[model samples]
Target: MYKAHFGLREQPFGITPDTSFFFACPSYQEALNTLLIAVRNGEGFIKITGEVGVGKTLLCRKFMTTLGDEFVTAYIPNPFLEPRALMFALADELEVSLEKDVDQHQLLKSINHRLLVLARAGKRVVLCLDEAQAMPLDTLEALRLLTNLETEKRKLLQIVMFGQPELNHKLQQEAIRQLNQRITFHYHLGPLNKDDMEFYVSHRLSIAGYTGGRLFGSSAIQAMYASSGGVPRLVNILSHKALMLAYGEGKHEITARHVRAAARDTGAARNKIWFLGWLAAAALITVGTSIGWAYFK
Candidate 1:
């Protein structure tokens, strides 16, 4: 709604995982580098975990885009399915044609054949599964078995799992201990810190065609950091809302009041500000009561 008013060609604070607006903060950059190195080493399994709305999905997409032509990628956005169904999803991603009512044996055979073909063609196959924590135990085991297809040199397929921190706990389960052990490289994505938060907002705004000076005031950025805890998703939600509020009042630059108002309008961002406000109020009340008692005494 405020795109034109803000001189932005597009909305800057969109929640969608657009690589163009990606901010290469230290944490995200390191995570991406870890993935590149692991995949290049022909690691069988790699894992990346982060909190909710910490930009895991965006990182996954950015990683795929950076691969060279020698890499063949299959992406499973949702892996919450049975073993056979998950296999079918992989087969579909790899363009492996299958007949109706294919049995488990034939399905596995088809996937193995596809992997072998890709290997022979001088291409490496990488399967990226997003939200992998929700994957069924049997499905995860099936994933481990799929990596067994290899030549004398290296494995025919590589797997990259991106999920929330619960995926780490899930991997620790005895049922999946073997898979966990196979994870040769792992990286945990963290939210941006205070310094990174400032650059992150500017980065997105610039990417969205904001050619002017700082759109978010210093106090506004502080309020955003306070409400978002430096989480990218929450920052985006608050920034977008703050922009709308500013535009509503025909204001050009966003202020702390705009950010706080936006945070109050958002469910996730609202909690942090409310707790901080409550703490501040309680502190003031305690100081006032103590001073009053001292004077009376």
Candidate 2:
């Protein structure tokens, strides 16, 4: 809605995991680097964890796009299936044809054969799973067994898991201890810091074709940082809302007042702004009382 007023080619703050809007903040870049290195080394299992809205899915998509022709990539966006069902999903992702009413044994066999064929063709198979925290315990073990089909030189299949922090806790369980131990390369993605957050906003705006001078005021950025706690998703939500508010007022520059109003409307940011506001009011009252007491003395 505000794109025309802001001169944006597209919506800058959309929540979709669009790789084009992927801001290469420090944590995201480091996590992607770790994934690339681990996969290139033929690591069996790699884990990337982050808080909700920390851009794990975006990073996963970007990683897949970064792979060369020598790499075969399979993406499974949902991992909450049973062992047999999960195998079926993997087979589908690998484009392995399956007969009607095929048993688990045949499913595994078909998958193994496809992997070997790809390996012989000098292609490294990489499987990426998003929202992996919901994967069943038995299904996780089945995934580990799939990795056992490696040749002498390297693993036949590499698996990358992107999930929230709960996935780490789930991996700690005894039921999936082996799978947990198999994760050779692990990276935790965190939210952007203040400087990175500012750059992130600018980067996204620039990618969306904004050539204006500082659309967001410094105080507005500070308000967003405090409200969003440097989280990119939250920042996007706040920024989008603030832009709307600014557009509604026919203003070019987004100010802290716009951000505060946006934060008030956002459920995740509303509490934080209210708390900060309370603190500010309390401090004002304390200062007023101290001055009155000093004057009376």
Candidate 3:
């Protein structure tokens, strides 16, 4: 709705994990590198954990796209299935055809055979599971069993799990110790820093065809960082709302007022009392600076 007003080709702050809008912040890049290196080395189990809306899924998608022909990847976006169902899902992803009446043993055999065949062909197999925290204990064990299918030289199948922080708690359970011990590489994705947030906002705007002058002022960006705690998804939500508020008032540039309004509307604006105190201090400093300048002149 504010695209035309802002001279942007499209909405700049959409919540979707569109790779085109991906901002390669330092933390994100490190996570990506960790995942890539782990996968390339054929690590048996790699785990990536992050807070909600911290771009784990986006990183997972980007990782998948970056894998070349040397590797075959299977992604399970939802891993809440039972052990048997989970095996069957992996089988489906690998295109291992099985009879309708096949049991768990038959399914495991089929999957193992496919993994061995791929291994023999010099292609590495990686299974990426998202939302792995919701997976049942038995299902997790089943996944661990899959990793056991290995040749004498190396593992036949590797697994990369991307999930929320709760996934760590799940892995810490006594029943899942075996799987936990198998994870050789792990990374915890964190929120962006102040610099990264600024770059991220500008990058998104630039990608959306913004050619106008600066839209968000320094104070506004600081306000956003304070309100969003440097989380990309929260930044997107606040920035989009701030733009809409600016457009609604027929303004060209976003100000602290717009950011405050956006933050208030989104309920992400914490420390209101402290914010007011800071505003007062800033106003006093501005007045003092003006007086000192006038006196010197």
Superior by TM-score: candidate 1 or candidate 3 = 1
Off by over 4 Å in 2: 271-297
lDDT of 2 by residue, 193-242 (tens): 99999999999999999999999889999998988988888998999999
Q: Which stretches of candidate 3 lie over 4 Å from their true place?
A: 267-297
**Local lDDT at 73 for model 2:** 96
| Superior by lDDT: candidate 1 or candidate 2 | 1
RMSD of every candidate to native, in Å, equals 4.5, 5.6, 9.5
TM-score of each predicted structure versus truth? 0.92, 0.91, 0.88
lDDT of 3 by residue, 76-158 (tens): 99999999989888999999989989987888899999998998899999999998888999999989988989999999999
List clash counts for every candidate, in order: 0, 0, 0
The TM-score, computed over Cα atoms with residue i paired to residue i, of candidate 1 is 0.92
In terms of TM-score, which candidate is strongest? Answer: 1
Of the candidates numbered 2 and 3, which has the greater lDDT value?
2
Specify the highest-lDDT model's number: 1
Q: What are the Cα lDDT values of the candidates?
A: 0.93, 0.92, 0.91
- Model 1 — which ten-residue stretch has the worst lDDT? 267-276
Query: How well does candidate 3 score on lDDT at residue 24?
Result: 84
